[model samples]
Every structure is written in structure tokens, then in C-alpha cells.
Target: MHVLPQVDSSPSLPRTKRVFFALNDYERRVFFPEYLAAELDALNGEAHWRTDELPSPAYWQTMMQELQPDVIVSCWSTPAVPFSLANAGSPLAYVCHLVGSVRNLVPRTFLERGGLLTNWGDIAGKTVAEHALLLALAALRNQPGWRPIINGPKAVPWRSGTMRLQPRSLYGRRVGIHGFGHVARALIRLLQPFDVEISAYSAGVPTGLMRSAGVTPFTSLLELATRSEVFFDCEALTPQSTASINATVLAALPDDAVFVNVGRGPVVDEPALVREAASGRIQVALDVVCKEPIDPASPLASLPGVILSPHIGGPTFDHFPHCGQRALENLARYLRGESPEALITPELYDRST
Candidate 1:
């Protein structure tokens, strides 16, 4: 009789399952909340110190060679993994991300090698949607321009007989969204209570989809822009969409309209946006800019109609542990030989790449 190796399939997990946390202390503080950290501590793992500034490939390779971690957990602050780590000799089997977009950090080769990658997914979208709403309301009220006139050294001193257009409220306004996506959909759901007329333009997506989501669908982006009192750009940032919103698109927005962009900055022509907002015809609220940590001298910084937040629309504090919990759930499934939810498919890889 031939003897075969027995597979250990038990409800009790392997205590020796190795995990590598690829983030420094600062990253841990920012991304890995205390609740999640405690959960991670229960899993057998070694914490590796690494920052984006010094993404030493050698350090990663050395750690992998020494510890031979079975899984890795990382965030935006973590550096890209070395391609060589996808080799058959490599012990790496899976990666869990707290961040949303993985195209930059996750190499296509890793996916090709049958590696599993999971992320926060819908958790990220919902939180970003919340920030988008905050910005829209702030833009509608022209809150950015208020601070100066109220009290600072730049106070306007309450002029005599100089009148202007009153800021519009989100209620009863026509809201148009360009690129109906997860974030846009969330925005619509949140907007349901406000009783705003909603219209959306999604390229390639069927018009009926948006209609079913309780929003009117427009054929072209220009038509959506022309009809909207407030316009949102929630399009994915891809090669096909870089700077898709140009001066012409900005021109299409109605006079005294509010333009809010929590999406990627490259989609909009920064110069054109500055010019339009400078004219006082458009109130621009942006969470992302063409260039991040915008220069102090940048014209957009001085514009009263423009409000800017430092790309903080996602990965909120309360959300850190939520992503970790989702990742842990998927990790459990992966160990059980079941399909891990949120695994990046070839189709998803194509859309992002």
C-alpha cells in the first residue's frame, strides 16, 4: 500500500502562519489603527520598518529570505514589491492592502504569478463619497472665500454698496456628475435626502444603469455640464481620461455654477480651471490638484472661489480598522481554500492599468 501525505484541514488555523507587515511606525500610526493593530498582533508576523522615501529593495528581499513570510500587509506608505519576489522560490503567497488603488504598488507580474491581492474596495469609495459631499456643501456656500472677509488681515472691511451673488445651497440645485462610478453612486445615494435633481454622464456605461440608480442619464458630458448648477468629476484617472475635462468643458458649466472635483487632478486643465474660477463665474472645490502640496504662489491658492483640501477624501481615521477587518476576513477565506472576496481579476487589472 502506498502512503500519501495527509492534508490538515481543521477549523483551528495554523498558528505558525507567517505574516509580514510592510510599514514603518509613522505609517502604522497613520494607517493601522489600534483596533486593527491588535488583530494583526494575534496573527503570527514580524513588523518590518519601511518608509516610501527609502524603499530599499534589498531590505525587502533580505526580510523575505530570513522570515519567508507567507503573507504581506501593506498600505500607500509601503514601497512597491520587487518583481523578483514573484519567483517560484519566493515564499510570498498573498498581499492585503488598506489603500484603494493597487496599480501603482502591485506589479502585474505578481498577479500573473497567481498571487492574491485584496484591498478596502467599497470601504474606500463610501468614505471618499462623504468627503465629496462635504466639499460640495462647502463650495455651494462659498465657505473658502468666507474666512478672508470675516476676520483675517485680508478682510474686505464690509464695503458700502458693493453687492454680489448669494451663495447657492445644495437643496433644490441640479447636480450633474461626470463619470458615474462607485464614488459618484455613493454621492447620489447620499444626495437622495436633499431632493436635488440628479443627472449623470458615464462613458461606455449603459444609460439605463444611471436611470435605474435614480438619476437622469445624459448622452454627452457637455449636455450634463450645461444642465447642472453643480458639476462633479468622479471619473477614473486613466490614460484615456487624462485631462478629459478641459477649458471647453469648464466653459460649458452655467455662469455662477459650482464645480467640485474630488477625483484625480490631471483630468482637469489646471490653467483653464484657474482662469474660469478667477473670473468669479465658477466656484472650484478640489481635493486633488494637477500637482499635489500645491505651491503657495499657485494662482488657485489665492482664488476666493476656490477651496482646496490636501487630497484627504479617502482613508479616513475611523476607516483604517474597517479595511483591516475586511482584509482579515478574506485572509481567512484564502487559508480555507475558498475564493477570497476582493481578489483583483484580470478585467479589473485591465481597467486600472
Candidate 2:
């Protein structure tokens, strides 16, 4: 039999209270693969809340009042874990959000009451960084331009005597990343083998670390845009950052430069991006859009040199179990009275997407 190192064959997790499944079946299947779920089931306590849709907020309050579970495991579709549900019986001791960003689902009261909140910040960073890398490569190679050929009939020959879009290589290109968070750092490491010049712009990253990583730290967005062959915007969306990438910043890039956005849509000025790409001054690829599903009337849907995906820039179904295992590890640590990793503090939330 094959041995999987990640599965714990040791004693079941010692727990005093119930652990609620604050996610749907699809999410559970992804995060808690069969083996891992079985391992968890073997733990000291039973898993609760297996509903496809979580109970109504009022009913949730009543459920909490009754069961007072010690732990709540959450994911993308989870509703906010209300303060009333937390207690000595349940205490709302910890929440393990398998996905990132608790800004919407996690209520402020939970944080105030000192409940342990954690997200996929422990593992999702690398996966998201890889998505950004995929966009970078697709943009560099002009994947959008050639995509129409695939949509066209196979009646035409793929080989052409004259190529319409000259494929560009990633080797030795100057790459600029707007935010030096986990995704940017992971991207920088991935680009190392390609021998690309890396520079980053983010107030959050220390100058010393950038220098140590062989990444040039550009203090201003304009400078990073002006100097790179390819640029990545991974900035978080905050009121202060909302229109940070305006027309002037986009125009600062050298002509024909590739720009990728795997970050928040609002961080880039939507109208300005549409105008820029329409003018053919710069190339752009996006996994996130200003409006979801891309409005049929939006010019971005037809613009040349623009590639878009429906915001699936992170780990897909197959890799979800890895993220799940990471969450289970955190759950085990909390049951053992240790500080679960990736605890979200106010400062951390402010910096996250």
C-alpha cells in the first residue's frame, strides 16, 4: 500500500466540544478529501452542521445557544459567525477559513471577542502566485491573440508561413510586481529560473528584504511601470488603493508591455484600462474584472490584446485537499491548546485581499 505522509495515523484529536462544518458538501469534498475526513471522524468529537445551506441567522443563533460548539470550520460560502453563537460551551474557539479573505464572512464582533480566525493564508498564497505566473506567461506569448484560431474551425492548418502574432519569450525580460506580498514573493522565485529582472513596488515590503531577494525595490508605481517588460498588479483593494492605478500610471508603461491583474478589480481604474487596451498602447490579461461575468455591453469583452478568466486564479479542485490538510493541521493545533497558524489580526485583515 502507498503511504501518504500528510495523513496522521496517530491518536485522534482530543476535543471537549463539537466541531461544526460551516461549509457546503462541494466545499467539504474539496477541502476534506475522503482519507482526511475519515481521519478527522476518528477524532474525539463528532462533526456537526452538515447542511447544504447554513441555517438561517436566527436559527444559527438558536443552534449556537443549544450546542455551543468549540470549533467552527468555514470556507467560501459560510455566513458570518455571529457573536451570540460563541460561549463557554462552544466559545467559538477557532475558525479555519479554507479560503482567503474573511472581510465579508467574519463579523467584526468575532474578532473583538478574541475568537481565533485563520484563512488559507498558510497555503493559498503559493497557488495564487502560480496563477499570476500563468497570466504573465499567457500575456508574454500573446495567448489571447492566438486563442481565436482554436475557436475557429480545425479545417485551417495551424502552421503558417507568416505568423500574425510573434511569440515572445519570458527569458531575460524585466518583470515588475506591484505588491510584494506572498504572491509576489512566490512569483519572484518562479521567475528566477527564467533569468528575468525582478523589481517590486509595495509600501508593505521592507527594502532590506527586496534587496536580499535580488529584487529592485521601486518606491513608486510610475517607476515600476516605466521600467518593466511585464508588470503584475497584486495590490489589495482598500479605500486608499481603489483608484491607485489610474490612466497616467497605465500610460507610464513602455509601449507593448504586458500587464497582468490577478488582484482586486477595483484596484485598477476600469474605464482607463478599457481605453488603454482599446488604443493598443499596452497589453493586458485579467483573472478578475471590475464587474463579475463581464457585462455584455462592456468593451473589455471585445478588446484586442485583452485576455480574461472568470476569477479562478487560485488552486482548482485537485489541489484543494492540500489546502484542507493545512486547515486540519491548524484545527489539531487549536485542540492541543496551541496558537493555530495564520491567525487573522486587525492589521493582517487590513493588509489582506
Candidate 3:
């Protein structure tokens, strides 16, 4: 346990809100630097931090009952906020998450009871879109083959004709995006310079909205896949979207079409995607997979026409401060009795990855 020095203890000031930091040691250092910690300390509150990465339930319960924090700053390693601490009668009112996906750290009942919650939100959208573009370009150029071609036993000639990987270009390509959320929108901006024709399909997103963004909106995923030379999966993970990209969708892509996914992996049928790539019918570049830190037996580990990354598609490590700052800003707003940005709604929560 650690506590920031109280900056104000005047009797006339409003009651000092108790702010708890439910982060492990590593998360604390990464998300809250000294300056950010000082900034948080500047708020009209007392900040108490948790040192344990995996505290016992009894320990957490005891701490919560003792501190009765009005706000909690949490991250990936933090445990789920207990039910007793999230009710209407509890003083705990807000949770400022330093990263995405509050579903693990927060209970749905917390929001259902009028408690506030905020995460990094769309701050990492541009980063994710940037990675999606990288994956597409890499897939078209056959990036995975370069290493083997250069280091293999066969001494291939330096001449361009000697190279066997038939690399392609992104110029004038027909690009189809499966989702029109933040990442997809940012990807559109990046694709403009490539002179690519863009089309998009999201379950309920209006075509008018896509048209306003200067992209054709398809009503069906199959139609989008049929027409696209490059297919991007950016759909969120939800009951409806899970396994939506099945064998039929994979079979729809034009031959040699590059497929990219920087979004949730379960959105696509993993086995179907694997079979498609294994057959050399389509090239794949994925930053996410259905089983993260992928199972060794997964075909993705050995497929030739596939490029896989360990889900490093967004807001790289250096960007932690930005998320921390956003959390601080949201906390400041809540303290000021002003509405916070990126408040997690029930709809957003229902669809979180």
C-alpha cells in the first residue's frame, strides 16, 4: 500500500474524496508516472494505491470496507469492483479506467446503479487504424516470406525476377472494412493517399453516415467481401458478431485478396480463416487471434501466407501516459461536478472486447 501526501487539509474545503488506486505495482508505474501521480494528488482527495497484483478477495474486501473510496483508478490487473462497493448507497461513485475494456474490472451492475465509469475510449483508435493499414500493406507485399527468402539455404539471385513472392501494391485497390467504428474511420483517412476505393459494412450503422465519409456502405458482409481486393475486419466482439466471418465470408474474397484484422479475433471464424490461408486462397495479416498468445497448435503459427502479431495493434507502450492523462482529466471533470468524457454506456459495455 502507498499513499500520496495530502495537498490540502483545510477545514473549510469540501470533504476530501477518498480516491483508491486499484493497480498492481507494474500498472502503477506504467500508467501513473510521478507527474501524473502528483497531478492526481492535487485533486481534493487522498490517494491510496494497492501494491499487490493479485490480492486475495478477503484483502480487497477489507481494504474497500476500510477506505470506502469515492473513486477508483483501475487497469488490466485490477480485480473486479465488488458488488458491495458499487451500489447506490456506497460512496464509491466513479471508476477511471486507464485503459480499454472495463468489463473485466467493473461489474455491469455498477453502471446499472448510476455509478460512473470511463476508459481510454477512442484515444487509441488512430493507433489501431494505423496498425490495420500496416497489416494490409504487409500482406499485399508478402512480408512474411521475406525472412525465409533471405535466410534460406537456396542462394537466390539479387535480381528482382529471382524473388518468388509476388508482392502487390495497395494503389487503386478496392478496400472493404467490416466495421465503421473509430478504427475503421481512421483507416479511411489513411487510405485516401493510396487512392483506394473504400466500402464499409456495419450492422446498424447508416449508409448515409458512410456516404458522408465518402465511402460506399454495403448492406451485407458477403457483398463487401465479394467486391473487395483487400478485406479489413474491424468489427467489435459481440454475440451477433462472433464467428460472423465464417467459411462463406472467407470463400467470398477474390483470389489473392489480402485480409487484415486488427480488431477482435472471435469476430472471424478462426478455423475457416486458417483453412483459407493454408490453402493459399487469401493472404492474412492479423494482430489479434481468437486465442491470444496463440496456442502453439494453432495453424496460424505455421501458415505460409499469414503474418501474425501478438495483438500489438494499438497505443504502443509509449502511449500509456496519454491514457493516464485522459483518466486524470476525466477524474478532474467528475470532481468539478462537470460531465466526464467517454462515459461507458450500457450499449458500449455490452459490446466491449
Candidate 4:
């Protein structure tokens, strides 16, 4: 087994740090090539970008032992064993691709061991929030079933006794944000132009900061849900928060109320949501699901009023470059014996605890 030695503590920083990139096969093909090039240029580092072809954990261990990179930047979809191997006192940064909790993808043991995590929170915030807003707008406009009308030039005559669609303007409407993290803050900023009344529910967030961002803080989740036309779930996933969206909360939503979830799938109860959406009691737009790449036969897919996307809330052309630049900057800091801007500390890991 080959091993790369740790960087020596010297006054002068190395010109180039040997870094390893481990990612899923799809990410490697679709996103990593450009990201790798950009990251190399940003950090001025010699990168060893590897796409793992091995079948099992043993193969990954072998590869890590041989590469012995100074730092490892990885996606959550890849196996954690390679990360565990490389993280034996080595600098490891987990790069978040979107706005979802990390608990689902990373093991508790990994967090306990002091693994550093980073994300494109600042850059990807507006992008994900915009996607969520788009979903809400589509739901409000009743666009899911109007594909034929939109695609065709023919206009249908209005019929009495049919549901009269009154488009609701976001202006002056109360918007409730479930989580007050980076993406939530960005969403609040975006909503400023619309003149919507914004309120947020968070346990640890400072009230002054939220107020400064033009969001009114709500102490109760139930109150927040009861009062808003649109509710955006941006909270992280944890044991407590997992399956947090229950029937009672779903029951409180006013008729034609819209639920936008760009967060984790497990954060909302899919079965309950399906029931509510099927009844036409509440509108739902989901970009994430409890099961990713949801099976074609899943009831959520066939539901009449639900707008389902294949977990693409954070996808945009800019995400790749933004993530790459942040990852490289973190690597550069690690080479200089300084903490990376995106580095995750043990305290953040303990947030779940």
C-alpha cells in the first residue's frame, strides 16, 4: 500500500498541493471535468481526479492508500469507506451539492470523528430558492394540467360550475420559511422585490438578523404553517426533524395552500402528503423525495395535483463552477496550514446531536 506523507509545517506554503477528487460516476461525467479544471486553476494545485470503477469498499481502500492525496474533496453519493480511510488525520472536506440536510448521506460515526464539511451555500442559495419559488408560482397558476392549452394555440370557452382560477399575487401575502439557514436567508432577500410579508421559524437563529432581513420571526411552527399561503422547508434532516411533517400540520393548511419542498425528502411525510394532494385539499411541489429517482409506479408520480421533479432544485450551469471554486479555495487553505473558509467544525456536526 502506498501512502502520501502529511504536509510539513513550514513558513513557506507549497505552490501546489496534491488533491484527490472522488465523486459519483454521473457527477464525474457531467459536472466534474469542468469543475476539476477550474478548481486546479483556482488553487494552483496538481489534482488527481479519479473515477472509481472498483466494485466494493476494498477496492476504494486500495485506491486511497495508493493515491495518498494531501486533501480529499468528495460528494455524498460516493461510498463513505474511502472517506473514512482518507480521513485518518488527513484533511477531508465534504462538498454539499444542494440545500438538504447532511445526516441522511453521512454516518453519525463520521461526524463524531471530526470530518470537515463545506458547501456552496452562499452561491447556490438564490438558485435553489428561485427553483422553489418557481414551483410555488406554477402551483398557484395551476399549470400542471394545462400542458395541452399552453402547447396548443386553441382557447377553450369558459364553462360555469368549473373551478374559477383566481391567480393570487405574492405581494402582501405572508410567506413562512421553515428553516433560517443560508438558503432561507437568500430566499428572504429574493422575496424582497415581490413585497411579500416574510416570517421564519428557527430555534437558534438570532431574531435581529432575521428582522434585519425583513423577516418576522415566529416562535411556533404551527402558527407559521397556519398563517402562510406558501411554506418553504429548508431545514436540515435529523432524527427529530425527519418525518416532521405530519398529518396534523397538513390538515392545518388552508384550501389551495401550497407546499414547496426543496429540502430533504424524509423531512416531509410522503404518504400523508400524497393523500392531501390527491384530495385536492393542498397543493404540493416536490423537488426531493424520500426515495431518490422515485420508481415510475410510485403513487406520488401519478397523483393529479402534485408537481414532481427528479430532485433538481439546485441544478444550474453556475453550480458546477461555484462548487469547484469553493472546493479549490478550501484545498488551498489546507495546504497553507490554515482552516478553509468552508470547513465544518465539530460543533456543526453536533447540531444534529
Candidate 5:
């Protein structure tokens, strides 16, 4: 009769939600360090970390069943949420992704089934915009060819006027942004000091919004390209948008116009872009390509006028903690029966890469 002491099973007690960190080593170290993990663990839940490489689908399913996570914080190397696990009435209620493009990490059915999803929305916009400016300035100033000029056999060609890669000034340039998303808006702000005339073209974006932002909105991409001295590709990737920057658009750019892409690559026709760059008609600076870690043998890699960055445009390494903080904020909001920021709607999911 030494029965169990009175157990407090009161309904007033807050329920604990299980949280799973589906991130690899690098992601864990950079995106979620000890302090951030502790912050998450302090929430009303038990936090579990996956330190090893991605597990097999079957293993993931088993783990999901065992832990039955109510929230998952995922990152670059995290495996895609299996369709079966997500669709078959799984306990997964929300997924807070620490980076962009959750298409690879999440399934469409997750949203369709009323599960909440969010990404580090607009947190990296300013940083990416800064990189876009860097690429534009580098291309305009012939940064790719500076090495030979600086290390040449001659001491220095005093008052060198006939440099092979002629430098161009970005000041007072006609800049056209292909999309008016967060990054594009940030670029507009950065370009304001230069007094450049900015025009933008995005399929569904309203002209009034652009006008309010001091931008000239174009109804067509070709029109924007034809008029721009510097064209930035910041459009999202979708089925209809694939290859939207085709031969016609590339051909429309003014001679020597700088084409910078900090956006997805498939939006541009790689072959056409290569042909344009090879012709020496335009300078191309890209942070992305059709294929990631672009093949060295690719023609785009050899062209002197083309400057390529290994897709480093983003909230810089130091800013990764900000993304983690955003994810945590969203998780807290969700736990409080409030809507999370940057909830990935079905439409947004479709619009993403």
C-alpha cells in the first residue's frame, strides 16, 4: 500500500514538445552552436541532435517514429522529409529551416497537410545585396584581369590608357533588377547613393509597389534587359521561369553591359550566356551556375570577361547565428499558438527553387 506519491498530472502544466535537430556536423557547428542548442533545449521540449551524416530513409522513418518530433530544425545537409513519413499523419507539426530553398529538405505534402514550415526569410537579403554590388563593381573594374596587369614584366605602365580589360564606372549607371524581392529591394537602397536609374521587372509584382520604391517597373524582361547597363538576376526559380533569361534576353543587353546573377542559375540559358560572354559583348559575374561547383571544363569558366564566385553570396559566416536566432524566434512563436514568420505557403513553395 506504499502507493506512488501524488503525481501532478494537472492540465495546467505546459506540455513538452519534442524537437529534433536534423543537421550534420558543419551545420551544427556553424548554424547551431552550444549556446543556441541550449537556448532551444530551454524551450518546453527535449532537444535531440543528429551528429552523424544523414541517415537512410528507413532509418529516418524509424527515428521519427521513436522521437515523434513536434518540431525539426534542419539545415543544408539534412535529408528530405520522406513523403510517406510526412503524408501518413506524422506527428511533425513544424519545420524551421535555417537556410533558403527548403524544396530539397521538405516535401510539398508537408504544407498541404497543414504542417507549418519556415525558412530564414529575408535575413540574408542585405548580405546578398552587398555581394551583388561587389560582383557588379568587380566586373565593371575588370577585377579578373587585375593580376596580369599588376604582375606584368614592366615596372608600371604610367598613365595606362589602353588596358586590355577596360574599366567601367558604376556611378550613374542604368541598373535593372530582374526581380523585386527582398534582395532586389535592398540593392535598390544600396544603389540609391550612386544616383542610378533603377528599373525592375517581375511577373506578378505590381507596378505601384515598384514606383513607391523609386523604381521604374517594366512589363517585360526583354525591355528591362535592353535598357539596362547592369542587369541583375534576382528572380526566383519556377517551372515557368526556367530559362526565362534566354538568347533573346541575353542578346537584348547593351554592349558591354554587366550581367550579374546572385539568383538561381537555371533561370538563364547557360549555353546562351556562354555564347554571349565568349563574344566579348558583355561582362558576366555570377555567384551561381546551372550546375553547382560548376565544371572547370565548362566554357563559362575560361572566359576572361566572366567572373564566377562559388555561390558564397549570403548572410556571411558570421551572420549564420542570426539565421539560427530567426529559426528560434519562429519556433517560440509557434509554441505560443501564434503564426511563425516566413511560413512557407503552398504558393511560396511552388515559387521556390
Candidate 6:
């Protein structure tokens, strides 16, 4: 494997640390260019821009060899190039667009080989967890469908009988979190003020951590579904987790239970979830879906008692600036001979990969 040459401070060009940006044309044209321009103005004439649409692995490899950039800023779930790029010397710092799951972004080999990975996980995790909590609250109060009616002009003369659903308090309700990852931890922290009991299920988590979080560790998915009033899917998508929430698990839940999925869509069986919602056995609030942009005719779209969002749980203006700054910070750290803060390791990969 090739390694990058040592930085030379006493050079002709000052070795201004060549960095490249890889993102789609639209993102480059709209969001990132201004972001890069503002945060990277200090680099001035040093930074280079390359806007490509899903460049092939060969194209990336060739570009790496030619430009020999000190670092690359990737804006997406996964970089287009193979792990060999890291092995071939140039380090890449990933600035994820949104959050929820990282399984699709980092390859197994890259994690095993110690690739530097940083994300807006701090911001995204907190934001999405709060969003999920809001959805749960909405469902509990039966405000999911009623809010739209009250907000419209017609609501000014609305009759009381039209919006008569008993609202329940969230206190004392059991909240089950599936997959004890970064987002789950954030959610647990956020729920501390609500005085709610918490439970979680994660194959990778240690008993000590679960105990520390004050969450009951459930050994089986059935237990998580059957016991909790609100079941939150915070797990990532992997072979082990794909379609993990099936009909059997859904059947175990209470008839009035609320199901919230802020995780990967594939982790839950969409059809089974649709059936549960359609049958009035469960209420669902989905921020992610198996098929993105959800097809118009999909059962999930028309399911009664389901609240759908376009997978925008983690996107906020606050998130972007922080993520961009963190990505740059990680790159700077790598350049300064220090390890990046959120470096992807074999252990993190082993869980999802």
C-alpha cells in the first residue's frame, strides 16, 4: 500500500494541503459550493473542486493518482471509490448529507482497514431522535391527523365533535428502542426529561452500557414489541437486521401500540407494517422507507393511522454547518498526524458490515 508523502513547510507553493470535494452537480451548485466557499475561504487558492455524478471506481482511482490530493471530502453515504484509495495513500473524510443509518455508507473492508470516517452524527442523531419522540407524542395525542385540520382556515369554524380523540400523557409509558447505536443513545438521553421507562435491544451492546443507560435489555425482538407502548426502530440495515421486524414481531405488539421507525426502512418489513397499520392494530410514523420517494401506490403511503415523512428527519440548517466544520476538523487532524475523532474501526464495521 502506498502512503502520502510528508508535508514540506519550506516549499515554493507552501504545500497548502490540496483537498478535493466530491458531490453531485446539484449539491455542488446549490448547497455545498457556498458551504465550501465560506468555511474553506482560509484555504483560499489551495482547495480544488471536482463535481462528478457517482464517478466510477476506476475514475476515482485515476483521479487520486493524478491529483494526489492530500485529502478528499466525500458528501454522501458511501464514497464511490474502493477502500484501496485509503490503502493507496490519500485519506478521505466523509461529510454525510443526512443521518439515521451509516450501514450503507462504509464498506466492511474500509472499516476493517482503519479508514477515517467523520459525520454529522452528533447533530443528526440528536435531531432525528427528537423527531421520533415528537412523532410518538403526536400519535399518543391523536394529533397526527388532527393538526392539519386545525391549521387550515376551515378550522376557524370547526365543531368540537369533529376533533374528539382522547389524548394520553407520555409519562409512565414504556419506550422500546431497537438497535442501541448513536441515535438510540441520543434518544435515550433526550427522553430522560419525560419520566418514561426505556428498554433496548442490540446485539452489539454490552450489558454494562445498557445498565448504565437505565434501560432494560430485552433478549428477543418479541419482548421489545410486546411490552413497549412505543417501539422505535433505530437499528441500521444489514443482513442480520434486514426485515428483522416481521409479521410475527408486529403481531406481538399491543393493539393500540405506536410503531416509529427512524432507522433504515429495510430493517422493518414494510408490507407487514402496512398490514398492522391498516388493520388498526398499530400506528406508524416512518421517517425512512425501504423504497425512497415512496411509490404512489405503495401500501405504506395509503395506510390508515400512519404518518409519513420524506426521510428528512436529520436535515436541518444547524446540522450542515456543524457537519462541514467537523469534516474539515477531521481532515486537519489527519494532516497534523493525529487520528480523526470518529475514525471508523473494525469493531464499528463488524456490527453492521
Estimate, for each residue in 247-267, the C-alpha lDDT of model 3 and write its tens digit.
999999999999999889999
| TM-score leaderboard ranking | 3, 5, 2, 1, 6, 4
Cα lDDT for residue 308, model 1?
Answer: 91
Over 126-231, each residue of candidate 2 has an lDDT whose tens digit, in order, gives 7778888888888877887676766666776676411656778889999998887777778888888999999988876688989998999998898889998899
User: Model 2 clash tally?
Assistant: 3
Best by TM-score: 3
Model 6 lDDT tens row, 1-353: 11223345465746656666665565444344364554455433245566566767677778777876555666662255445555534444432322223555556555445455555555677888888888888888776658666666764665652546556777888889999887899999988888989998887678689989899999989989889888999887768899999999999988788899988899988888888888887778889889998998998887657888888777565566566666656666665667766655556555542
lDDT (Cα, tens digit) per residue for candidate 5, span 142-232: 8988887767668566447346767888999999999888899999999998889999999999999999999999999999999999999
Q: RMSD for each model, in Å, please?
A: 6.1, 5.1, 2.2, 4.9, 4.5, 5.0
Worst 10 residues of 5 by lDDT: 1-10
After superposition, candidate 4 runs with Cα above 4 Å error:
1-17, 23-47, 51-55, 82-115, 148-164, 350-353
Candidate 1's TM-score reads 0.84
Cα RMSD of predicted structure 4: 4.9
Report the poorest 10 consecutive residues by lDDT, candidate 4: 91-100
Q: What is the lDDT of every predicted structure here?
A: 0.76, 0.78, 0.87, 0.68, 0.86, 0.70
TM-score of each: 0.84, 0.88, 0.94, 0.80, 0.93, 0.82
Q: After superposition, how far is residue 177 of candidate 4 from its true place, in Å?
A: 0.9
lDDT of 4 by residue, 1-353 (tens): 11234445356964345666666566554444543654455554456655555337787777767765555556655555455543456444333332224444455455566555555546666788888888888887776766544454445554311244545666777788988776788788788788888888876778888898878898767788887888888876767778777787777777778899987789888898889989998889888889889988989999877888777777476576556566666666766667767444554554432
Off by over 4 Å in 6: 1-17, 24-46, 51-61, 77-79, 82-107, 111-114, 147-163, 350-353
lDDT ranking, high to low: 3, 5, 2, 1, 6, 4
Q: What is the C-alpha RMSD, rounded to one decimal, of candidate 1? A: 6.1
Give candidate 2 misplaced runs (Cα > 4 Å): 1-15, 52-54, 86-90, 147-162
TM-score of 4: 0.80
Stretch of 10 with least lDDT, candidate 6? 92-101
